[model samples]
Structures are given as C-alpha cells and as structure tokens.
Target: MDTKSLLIDTATTLFQQKGYKSVGLTEILKACNVTKGALYHHFPNGKEELLITCLHGLNEVITTDIKAIFSRHLSTKDAILSMIDKLILNFEKNDTIIGYTFSSIVSEMATMSEPVRIACSALYENIQNLYHEKLLTEGYSNESASAIALLLTASIEGAIMLCITQNSATPLKTIATLLPSILEVNK
Candidate 1:
C-alpha cells in the first residue's frame, strides 16, 4: 500500500484498539515506517484531519455494506434479521469490532470537537433514516416506523458495546431473541 493508505490503516487499527487520544502520530509513523514529513505530505492538518478522513471512509464502508446486506431480503423483517445475523457474524470473527463501530470515539470527542461530532451525528442519522425507510416500506406508520428504527438503532449499538465490554456474545444473542418481539414482527 502507499504511504497515505498505510498510515490510515495503521492508525485505524490503533484507534480501534486504543482510541483516538491514546494513539499518537509518532506511533502511527513508526508502525508505517514513514517519516513525519510523509504523514504531513498526505495529511496537512495532522492526526485530527487523518481521523476525519478515516471517519468518512468508514461511513462509506458502513453505508455500502449495510445496504448490500439489507437489499438481498425483500421483507423488512427479514432484512432486519439479516442485519442482526451479520452483526453476530462480525462479532464472532473479530473480538474487537473497530471500524464497524466508533461509539467510544464519539463519546470521547463529541463534546470537544465540533467537526467530529457532526460527522458522527450525520453517520448515525443516515443509518437511522435508512432503517426508518425500510420500516415504512413494511407497512408501518411514519411515526411508528421512525420510533422503532431509533429503538433498534439504539439497542443494537448498546448490545455491541455490552458484548465487547463483557467479552462475550451473550448480549448479542439475548438481543437477537428479543428483537422480533420488540419490533412486533413474527418470525
């Protein structure tokens, strides 16, 4: 990979594992075997700018992957189940789900950094909007669809954090079992 791509990839892994503030530019440079000048050449504004770039790239990845997963199933209920299943698969494969989630980073930065806050908020809103649209298409009223979408989004994110914190898939499994009932969908 090129220097810029290598730097981003390295930083992404570090950020995922240790968070944004914990990882320094020097660490990223060391991992990538690049000089500070190289990093500056690619990212003029430094770590924050690179993080923003990473966030944007992560948003694109999430949007595309989620749409692809949900598109295969015609029914909203099926699509949601598919998504939950995919989440389970992802969690099972990687003990630490990095790029797929950045809630920790958002919580740490939201109050302090306006740009990061806006980017995180926009990413969440887009996902919620997508869920709302799917629910509406499935015959739910607008208000009910939006409420349910928000509930599902909140629940899933919480489940991910809980699962990671506890180092077990129990939270995910429990949530999956309750989701159909919570959404009032017969499965």
Candidate 2:
C-alpha cells in the first residue's frame, strides 16, 4: 500500500498489540519503514492524529461490513448470528491478537483526548445504529428495535472481551447459540 496507509496500518496494529500510550511515532515509522517526514506529511499533529485516523478507518471498515451483513441476511436474528460467526472466524484467522482496535486505545485515551474519545464513541453509536436499522427492517417496533440493538451491541462487545480474556472463541459461540432466543418474538 501507500506510505500514509502503511503508517496508519502499522500504527494501528501496534496500538492494538500494545497500546496508544506505549506506541510512539518512531516505532510506528520503523515498523512501517517510513520516515518522520512521511508520517508528519500525512498526520500533521503526529501520533494522536494518527490514532484518530486509525480509529476512523476501523469504523468505516466495520460499519460497511455490518451494513453488508444486514443487507445479506434480511432477518435480524440471521444477521446477528452471522455476525457472531464472522467475528469468531476473524478472531481465529487473526490468531485472536487482533480485535476492535479502538477499544484498546479508547480506554487509555478517553480521559486524555476529547477527539479520541469522541471518535470511539461515534464508532460505537454507529454500530448500534446499524443494529437498530437492521432490527427495524425485520419488522420490530421502533422501541423494541432500539432496545434490542443496544443489548446486542453490548453483548457482542462483552462476548468479544470474554473471547480475548479466555483465549477461546467459546464465548462468541455461546453467544451466537443463545442470542436468537433473546431476539425471538412471541406471537
């Protein structure tokens, strides 16, 4: 890829592997094989700006994937179950070292940088909104859709954390198996 994208990807990977506080611009440049000039040319404000950009990039990727999943599934339960499966597959494919990049950074930077915090918050809301829209398309009322979406988002995040902490995808699998019952509507 290009130098700017390389720097961002390298920085993001490092941040996810390590943390924003622990990663430095020099390390990012070294890992990316770019220079200070190249990094600054793209990220004028340096590491913090790069962090925000990386978070936005992650958000765009995830949001697009979620939207596509919703479109493909049509049914809310199908979409959620598919998402859980995909998440587990992705974690396994990446050896479980990769995860929501923003989550790792946001917890550390939330009190330090408003921009970083806002970016993280906006990403989460976008995810929730995607869930909400998909549930609406599945014919749920607005109130039920909103609540279910929020619960799904929270549960999925928690499941991911459990998968990471436990070093297994069982949590995600369990969630996938149990989630549909939660989404089921009685006639």
Candidate 3:
C-alpha cells in the first residue's frame, strides 16, 4: 500500500486496540514508518480527519464482508452465525477485532466530534441496512426487518464491547447462541 493507505491501516489498528482518544499521531507515525509531514500531507486537517477517513473506510470494508457473507448463505441464521463465527475466530487470533473495534471508538468520541459522530452513525446505519436487506430477502416484512436489524446491530456491538472489556470472548460466544432465536421470523 501507499503512504496514505499505510497510514490509515496503521491508525485503524491502533484505534481498534485503543479508542481514538487514547492513540497518538506519533504512535501512528512510528507504526507506519511515515513522517508527520507525510501524514499531514495526506490528511491536511490532521488526526481527526484521518480518523474520519479511517472510519468511513472501515465501514465500507465491513459492509463488503457482510454483503459477501450474506450472499453466500440463503438463510439469515446461517449468515449471521457464519459472521459471528468469523468474529470469534478473529477475536481469538488478534485479541482485538479489526473493524469491530468501532463501537468503543464511536462511544468514546461521538459527543466530542461531529464528524466522528456522523461517521459512526453512518457505519451503524450501513450495518443495520445490510441485516435488514438479509431479513427482507428471507421474507420478513419491512417493519420487522428494520426492528430486527436494529436489535442485531445493537446486540452484536454491545457484545463486542463486553468481550473487549472482559478480556474474554465469552460474551461474543453467548451472543452467538442467542442470534438464532433473535433472527427467527414469524412470516
């Protein structure tokens, strides 16, 4: 990857491990092996700007992953289970999830920055829509699909936060068990 891409990747990883507020530009610089001048050149507005870009990029990456996973499975339950399984594996490998670290970053910085708040909201909306589309595909009504999508996104994000804080993947595993019931359709 190029300097800008490398910087965003490095910063995203750091922001995932520690929320945006806890990470420093110097650390990002060191991690990416790029100079502050290069970072400023790519993100003239600075760290917040870079973080917003990273957030947007992370959302797109997640949306892509969910879309692919959803397409691979005809059933919503299987798709979501596969997703959770993937999450569990990733969390086991990294101890901190890649794009999944998003919730805490948003919770930490949303009120402090309008751009960050907007980015986080957009990310949530996009993920919800992905689930909503899947539910609709599986014969759910629009209202039910919307509600379930909201519930799923909130539950998964909350579980990720708990897993991160508790230093264990039990919360995610527990949530995975509950998803099948949550995803059940009455239609």
Candidate 4:
C-alpha cells in the first residue's frame, strides 16, 4: 500500500483500539515505520489530520454499506430488520460489537473538537436520512418515519455497546427480535 493509505489504516486500528485522544503520533510513526518527516510530508496537520482521514475512511465504509443494504425496495420494517442483521453479521465477523471506529471516536472527541464533531454528526445524520427515506417509501408519515429512524439508530448503537461490555451477542440478538415489535410491525 501507499504511504498515505498505510498510515491511515494503521492510525484507524490504533484509534479504534485506544481512542482518538489516547493514541499518539509517535506510536503511529513507529507502527508504520515512517519518520516524522515522511508523516508530515503526507499529513501536514499531524495527528488531527490523520484522525480526520481515519474518520472519513470509516464514514465511507459505514455509509456505503448501509446504503447498499437499504437500496433494496423492501418495506420499512423489513429494511430495518435487514439493517439489524447486517450489524449482527458485522459484529460477529469481527468478534466485536462495540469499538466501532467512528462511533467510539465521536463519543470521545465530539465534545472537544469541532471538526471531529461535525464530521461525526454529519455521518450520523446521513445514516438517519437513509433510514427515514426507506420508511417514507414504505408509506409512513415523514415526521414519524424520521423519529423512528433516529430511535432505531440510537437503539442499535446502545445495543452494540451493551453487547460489547458483556462480551456477548445476546443483547444484540434480543434487540433484533424486539425491534420489529417496537416499530409496530406485525412481523
């Protein structure tokens, strides 16, 4: 891989594991075996720039995957169920239901960093919009659909956190089963 890509990937892994404020530039340099000059040559703003790059990379992964899953013209309920299943599959594959790169960082740094906060917030809004659009297409009123979409997003994030803390997918599974009921779907 190229230097920029290598740096971003290494930084993403480190930040995901250790968080944005906790991880340092020196560690990233050492991990990538690149000198400070080389790092600055690629990212002039140092750690912040790298962190932003990582955030953007993760945002693309999230938005793209979500859009792909949501593009199917299923009913609102079915679309949500499919999205939940996608989350479960992702968590299972990675052996981690928590520690999501962007979510974790947003929670950590949003209070302090304007740029990071804006990026994270925009990402979340985009996802919520996608959900709302799907709901509207399924015949729900706009106001109710947007609210439900936001609730589902918040619930899924909370569920992921709970599952990670307990080191089990039971909570996630429970949420998946309960989601349809909460959404007032007969299925």
Candidate 5:
C-alpha cells in the first residue's frame, strides 16, 4: 500500500494489539518503517489525528458490512443470526474480529480525547441505526426496535469480548443458539 495507508494500518494494528496510550508515534513510525517527518506530512495533528482517521475508516467499513448483512436477509432475525454465525466463523478462522477492536479503544482512551470519543460514539450509533431501520421494516414498534437494536449491539460486543478472552467462539456460538427466541415478535 501507499505510505499514508501503510502508516494508518500499522498504527491501527498496533493500537489494537497494544493500545493508543501504550503506543507512541515513534513506535508507529518504526512499525511502518516510516520516519517522523513522513507521518507528520500526512497527519499534521499527529497521533490523535491518525487514530481519529483510523476510527472513521473503521466506522465506514464496519457499517457497510452491517448494512450489507441487514440488506441480505428479508427478516431482522435472519440477518442477525447470520451475523452471529459469521462472527463465530470469523473469530475461529482469523482469531480476530476487526470490529471488536473498537471496544478496546473505548476502554483505553474514551476519556482522553474528544474527537476520538465522538468518532467512536458515532460508529456505535450508526450500527444501532442500521439495526433499528431493519427491525422497523419488519413491523416492530419503534420502542421495540430501538431497544432490540441496542440489545443486539451490546450483546454481540459482549459476546465478542468473551470469545476473545476465552480464546474460543463458544460464547458467540451460544449467543447464536439462544438469539432466535429473543428475536421473536412477542419478545
């Protein structure tokens, strides 16, 4: 890839593996094999700016994936069930769920930077909005769709964390098995 994209990808991977606080520009530059001057040329505002860019790119990619999943199925339940299955298969194969990396950022740096904080919050809302719209199309009440959207987002995030911590997809698998009842109209 190009230098700018290379820098961002390396920094993002380091941030995911280490954390924003633990990583420095020097480390990122070293990881990318780029110099400090080269980084500043692209990211004049430095590390926070780079991270904010990373977050924005992640938001677009992840929301697009979510939107695609929501659109690929006729029912909200089917879409979400497919998402859960994909989550399990992804974790099993790659040992990493890319979107789940956002949780680590929230835990490590939410209070440290305003722009970055807002970026993360927007990403989460975008995800909820996608689900909310999908559920609304299925004739769910506004309140139910809103609440279920939140539940789905939060539950999947939590399950991914559990999967990562336990080094197994069993938590997400369990969620997949139990999610159908929760998605019922009467629920």
Candidate 6:
C-alpha cells in the first residue's frame, strides 16, 4: 500500500525466493518501483535493515494467522493439523515455501549480523509462544506446554528443511501424519 510497506513486501518475497545475500537493493527497488531515496527514508540502515523489516512483516502475518487458526479450531491438535495442512496445500499449489527460504537466510546471516539473527530468533520465539499458549489451553502444565511447543516448532521446521532439500513434500506429510500421536494432544 504505502512505499515502506511495498518495499517490505517486495523484499520479503524476493528474499524468500532468493537469499538475502544474493538479492541486492537494486532488485528490491525495481520490484517495488521505488527509488533509493524512498528505501533509505524508510530503512536508514540499508539492506540489512530492510531484511529485518521484511522478517518482521512476515512474522506479523504468521502470528496473526496462528491466532486466527487457534481461535477457530478450539483444539490445539486441530489447530496445528490445520496449519500443517495449509502448508501442504500451499506447497502443492505453489511448489515453493517461504519458510525454507527464511531458513536459508537465517543459516547464512545468523553469524554475520546480530540484528538479522535477533529477528530470526524473535520470529521463532513468537511462533513457539503461540504454540505454547495453545498447549496451555489444551490443559497441559506450563513445563509440558513449553516443551511440546518447542518440539513442535523444531519438528515442523526440520520437516520443511528436509522437504526442501529432498525436493519432496513427503517429509512434511509424514510429520503431519505422525504429529497427533507424537504430541499426545488428545491426552
């Protein structure tokens, strides 16, 4: 909508398709149809700042979706399954996933830039917190909920990485099938 938002959205998509290291400010500028002045005005620190902002924007959307999905499902397992199903459908339709791309960005930038690393860590923590809250609502103890949340996050992220690396969604689908039993959400 606005120039800043447009830049972030464009950068997010580009950085997802191409790693942050490979994508230049010029590509973002051209894609967003904005000049360097507009980008610098919104992101004074340059491309890294833009990457951080893009991560923030992406995390915001994910958090909102998690809330909405959790609210609608009424069961933690159902909510998680629905989220996984959505991921499967997205990959089946688009044949690409932003999570895989973001994983790449995190792996590459985690050692190079503190801000980028923090942004990725915060994004992960936010997702884990969302899952933790859901587990709490399902009557798990605080410790149990926290651990389950972390496990779920790691499993899903690992499945996505494996899916991308192996060029098959079977890993994700397998995890989706096994999650209900592994999570013991019904208990």
RMSD of each: 2.0, 1.7, 1.1, 2.4, 1.5, 1.6
Model 5 root-mean-square deviation: 1.5
Which lDDT tens digits does candidate 6 get at residues 30-134?
998889999999999999999998888878888998899899998888998998888877777777765434787888899999999999999999999999998
- Decide which is better by lDDT, 1 or 6: 6
**After TM-score superposition, what is the CA distance of residue 31 in candidate 3 from its true location, in Å?**
1.5
The predicted structure with the larger TM-score, 1 or 2, is: 2
The residue-by-residue lDDT of candidate 1 on 14-89, one tens digit each, is 8767889999998999999999999999999999888887777778887887788778877666777787777787
Query: Given candidate 3, what's the lDDT at residue 169?
Result: 85
The runs of at least 3 residues in candidate 5 whose Cα sits more than 4 Å from the true structure, single-residue gaps closed, are 185-187
Question: lDDT tens string, model 3, 16-110?
Answer: 88878889999999999889999999999999999999998999899999999998999988998899889888889988676777988888999
lDDT of each: 0.81, 0.84, 0.89, 0.79, 0.85, 0.86
Clash count per candidate? 0, 0, 0, 0, 0, 0
TM-score against truth, every candidate: 0.92, 0.93, 0.96, 0.88, 0.93, 0.94
Clash pairs of candidate 6? none
Decide which is better by lDDT, 2 or 6.
6
| lDDT accuracy of residue 108 in candidate 4 | 91
Clashing pairs for model 1 are: none
Residue-by-residue lDDT tens digits, candidate 5, 33-146: 999999999999999999998888888888888889888899988999888888888888889776556788877778888888898899889889998999899998999989
Clashes of 6: 0
What is candidate 2's TM-score against the reference?
0.93
Selected candidate, larger lDDT, 1 vs 5:
5
Highest lDDT model number? 3
- Candidate 6 to truth, TM: 0.94
Root-mean-square deviation of candidate 3 = 1.1
Candidate 2: tens digits of C-alpha lDDT, residues 163-182: 77687898899989888998
- Provide the lDDT at 29 for model 4: 91
